[model samples]
Target: MSTADGPSDKNIGCAIYLHIPFCVSKCHYCDFASYAGKSHLLEPYLNALLTEIGSASVQENTRRIGSVYMGGGTPSTISPETAEKIMSAVAKKFNPSASSEKTIEANPESVTPERLAGYIKAGFNRLSIGVQSFNDRNLKSLGRAHDSQRALEAFDMARKAGFKNISVDLIYGIPGQTLSEFAEDISKAVSLAPEHISAYQLTVEEETPLWDMVEKGTVIMPEDTLLLEMFEKTVTSLSKAGYRHYEVSNFAKPGMECKHNLSYWLGEEFLGFGNGAHSFINSSRFANPDEPEDYIYEVDTAGRAGAEILGDEKDRVLEFLLMRLRLVGKKLTFKELDEKFFPFGRHDKHGPRPLFDETYRHPLDWISKNGLAEVNSDGFTLTHKGLLFLDDILLEFEKV
Candidate 1:
C-alpha cells in the first residue's frame, strides 16, 4: 500500500518475481497456481503482464530493482521470442542494474539450444533447470516430461549457450526412491558442477494427485527414517562436492547463492508481477488474481490487483525470524532485530518483544543443551541436527 522505508532500506534493493503460470503438463506433486491447458491464453496474459509492469513504473519507489526472476508453470515452455518480449518490457520499465541477477526457470524438455541462446541474449545471467531426479523411473513417478538423458542434454545446451551461472533443482523422498538412488542423483548433479543445486523433500500436499494416491494406498512414501537418511545424504554429498549448505535445501558454490531468493529470506521488500504473483512492500502484502482471465480483467479495469495487509508488526517479526532461521550458517542477530523491529530495546512501546531476548532463555538453553542449536550472546544458529527438527524449534519460539 505504501512505499518501503526504514533504517533497513538504506541500500537494500527490491527483488522482482515474474510468474509464468502456464505449463505443458502438471506435475503429480505440484499444487502451485499453474494451468496445464492454458496455452491459448498466453498472449493475452503476457500483454496484461506488460501493462501491469507499466503501471508499477508510474508509481515507482526509491528501491532499486536488484534482481528479476522468471519462475513458472515452466517459464521455458514459452517461445524465446515471447520470453524476449517480456524481458524487453521489464528492461523498459524497471531498468534493472546491469549487475542484477536475472534468472529464468526452465524444464529439461522445454530447453533448446536456440531458446538458451535467446535467454542469454535477452540479458539473463542465471539459469535454473528443473532436474527433479536423474532416474527415468523417478521422472515418470513424478510426472516429469523429460527423462535423465534430456536433463543431461539440457545442462550441456545451457553451458554451450554461454550460461555460466546455472542451478539444478531436485526432489528427494519420492514414493519409490531409495537412499542409494538419491545418492546417485546427487552424484550426477555434482559431476555437472552447477553453480547451485536445490534438493527438496517431496511434500504430499492436500488434494493433489500425489495426496490422492497416498490416500488410496496406491503409492506409499518412504519411511520417515529413510527420508531423514536421504536428507543427510543430500547434505553430506553436496558438502563433500564443495557446495555450501547455505539454506535448508539449497546448496551453492562459494559466493554463488541465489540473490533473488536470498533477498526473500532476509525479509527484504519484493514486487511480484503476473497472475498468481504476490508482493510485499512497506509492511503490507498484495496478490494478483490466480486466473489469467481474472488477472487480465483486473489489470484492464483497476491497473493493479487488490492488496491485503498481512498483520501488525508482531506478525512481521515472527515471519522474519522464521525465514531468517532457514539460513544455515547465518546468525539471527539481535542487533538487526532491534534496529529493524524493536528500536527501543525490548521495552519498546510497539513491541512483540524479540524472541531472542532473556525471557526465552530457558527454551534456548534447552535447545543448546540437546545440541540441536547454538545460542550465544549475539544470537542463535540451528545446528545441522536442529535443521532436521526446524519445525520443532519454531514451535519452541511460538510457545512464547
Candidate 2:
C-alpha cells in the first residue's frame, strides 16, 4: 500500500468503480443511492451493471484498469456470488490485473466467515469494513445495523480469509460523543492494528433522516466549530496511535494509503457501473439517477447514461484545488499547471504576469504567510499546522 508510482512520465488507462446500491438498513445521515426495501430489485440492478460494463468496453480499448472499487450501500450486503458475478463481468470487459488492488466496502454483519471466503475466492484482495462508530450507543443513533463487536468480528473474518490489505471506516463527532470517548475508540482501534482508517466527521445531508430530526428538534447536528475540534482531536489521537494523516479524513499505517482514493485526488480518469454510479473519464463526471428501477431500466435497455462534461477549464482547476488540499505533503507544478490548464487571463489576475486564475486563486501566498503551506521549486504543500486548517484553506478556493 506504499505509494505506487502511477505512470511517472504520463498517465493512461482508467479506474473502474462499481456502486452497490442495496443496504440492509439506511443510516440516519446517509442519502447515498440505496434503499432498505429494495431487495427485490437486486437481480435487475446487477444485470444493468453488467450491461454497463459490457458497453464501457467499446468506448476505448479499455486498457489496464488500475483498481476496482466496489463501494456501497454495503457491497457485502449481497452474497459473494453477487461479487463474483460483477467481477466476472469486469474481467470480460477489462484487463484488470490479479494484483490490481480489488476492494469491497463491507458492513460488519454482512461479512461472515463464509462470505469472507467467497470474497477471497472472487478475487477481492482488499477490504474496507464500515465500523462507523465504536460506541454502541452512537451506532444505534446512526442506524448502523452492526454493533461494535460485530465490526471486530468482521475484521477477524477478513484476516482469516487471507486479506493482507485491509481498512476500516470510523465516524466521529456524533451529537453527544465526547472527545475522551473518541480517543478511547481510536485507542481500541489501534490495538487491532488495521493498515488503514477512514475517520470521517459526520455531515448531515439535507434529505437524511438525521436532517429531519434536526428540523423537528429531535437531533442536533454539531456546529462547525465543534466539527473542527473533533477533526483536530482525531488528527492528534490517530497520530499518537501510530497512524499518519495521509488525507484530510483518512489515516493510514505507513505504506497503506488508499490508492483508489489517491486516484481521485490526482484527477485520474475512471468509469463506473451499477445503479446511481458515477464516472470520470477525460475530465468528466456524471452520475445515474438514484431510482433503482430507472437506473436499471436505462442501463439494461440503453447500456449507457448520458454524461455531463465539465464545460469550462474553471471546473477542472477548482476540482484540482479541492482534491490536492486533502493530501498532507504533495505539491503541484505551477508552471506546468499554468501551461496545461490556465493558458490565459481567465483567472482575472490583478495584473502583470499570470499571478492567478478564477478557478484556483493559488492560496500559496496566504497559506505560506500563515505558515500553513509552502512552495518549493514545485508548487506548494500543507504544513502540519496547515493540515489542521486544511478545510478552511480549501474553502478559500471558493469565492470570497
Candidate 3:
C-alpha cells in the first residue's frame, strides 16, 4: 500500500482530477455536471476519457502528481473494470508519487464489497462515500436511492475490502430536517471513525427539482437560525469526537485531510479531465464542454478547449484571499502572497506593499474588531466565529 506524507509543497507537485459524470439516478437537489439514465453513453465516454488523458499527457509538461481525485455524478456508478481502465490510463500517462492520494467518490447505493475491492486493486488508496444522511426520511426527502441501512453496509463493505483511508460525506439543513436529525447523522458518522468527514449545508440551486418543490410549498427548508444551530452542533460534536476542524466544512483525523482538495484551497495547479470538468493552471482556468457528446467531439477533434486567462492582478489577489480563507487553522502569510502574485518582487519605492493595504484595511479592520479574524505583522487567520460568516466576510473583501 502506498503512503503519502501530509500536504506537499504547492510549487513542487500538482494534482489531477477526473470527472465521471454518470449517475444511477439524479438526486432532487443536485445541479452538478452529471447525467442520469445515460448508461448507453458509458462506454463511449470511457473511451473519450482515455483519449483525452493520452492527449493531456503529451501537452501537460509537469513533474510527478501529488494526488488523483476521481469525482463525479457518482463515480461508482461505472463498473469496476471500466473504472480500472481509466485508472490504468492515468497511471500510464502521469507519474503519481507513491505517497500520492488516489481517491474515488462513491455513493452508497452503487458501492459493493466486490466493487470496493476492485477499486483498491485498481490503485485507489482512498474512498469518499456520499452518505448524505443516515435518516431514512431525510434520505427519501433528498431523493437518495439508498436507505440508512445501505449506507451503514457500504461502510462495512469498504472496510472489509481493506480500505484503511475513508471519508464520509454528510449534509445538513435538508428540507424538513430537524436539528436532532442532523445531530444523529453526525453521531453515526463519527461512530464509523472514517479518516475524514465533510458536512456541507445544503444549498438549493435554482433549476433543481428541490427548488421547484420549495417554490410550490411542497418542501420547506430549515430557517437560518436552525441551520446555524446545526452547523454549531457539527463543529462541537465532531471536535469532541476527536476530529479536527480543518476547513470550514471539513474535518479530519490527524493527517487524513483530502490532499486533492487541499491543493485547490492552497492555489496549487491541477489538471481536470472528463465532461464539464474545470482545470486551473498558471493563473488560467480551462473548462471542458458540459455535454458529454460535445466534450467527446472536442477531445477527438482537438486536444482540448475552453481556456480563460485571469489576467487581472486584482482578480488573482481576490481569488487567492478567498481560497486561502477557507482553511480553518492556517494563516495566509505575506511570503505566500508575494511568491504567487509578485514572483519577481514587483513593488514601488516602499520595497513591497503591505498585503493588508488601504483597500483591504476596511474589511480587515471590521473583521479584526469583531473578533472574527486575527491580523498580524505576517498575515491573517479567521477565528471559528469568522468561518460561520465566511461568505459575508469574503463579500466584504470582494467589495473592497
How many clashes (backbone atoms < 3 Å, residues ≥3 apart in a chain or on different chains) does model 1 have? 0
lDDT of 1 by residue, 1-400 (tens): 0011101223447899989998889999998878899998888888888888877845454568878999978999888888888888888888898889999999999889999999888879999999999999999999988999999999999999999999999999999988899999999999999999999999999979999999999999899999999999999899899888888999888777788887788788899999889888876788887888899889889887645856776577667767777878666766776677667665766554543456567768878998988888887777888888887877776665
Model 3 CA deviation exceeding 4 Å by range: 1-12, 57-61, 309-311, 344-356
Q: What is the C-alpha RMSD of each candidate to the true structure, in Å?
A: 4.3, 3.6, 3.1
Task: TM-score each candidate.
Answer: 0.92, 0.89, 0.93
Clashes of each: 0, 2, 0
Which ten contiguous residues of candidate 2 have the minimum total lDDT? 3-12
lDDT of 3 by residue, 1-400 (tens): 1123223344435789999998888899999989999888888788889988887745474646889999999999887898889988888889686668999999999998999999988889999999999999999988988999999999999999999999999999998899998999999999999999999999999999999999999989889999899989999999899887878899888777788888888788888899988888766788888888888788778866445654577777787777778888677776677677666554656575544444477888889998888988777778888989888897888887
Estimate the overall C-alpha local distance difference test score of candidate 3: 0.84
The per-residue C-alpha lDDT of model 1 at residue 258 equals 85
- List the candidate 2 regions with Cα displacement exceeding 4 Å: 1-13, 57-61, 223-226, 343-363, 376-378, 388-391
Ranking by TM-score: 3, 1, 2
lDDT string, candidate 2, 68-112, tens digits: 899978789879898998999888888687877789999997788
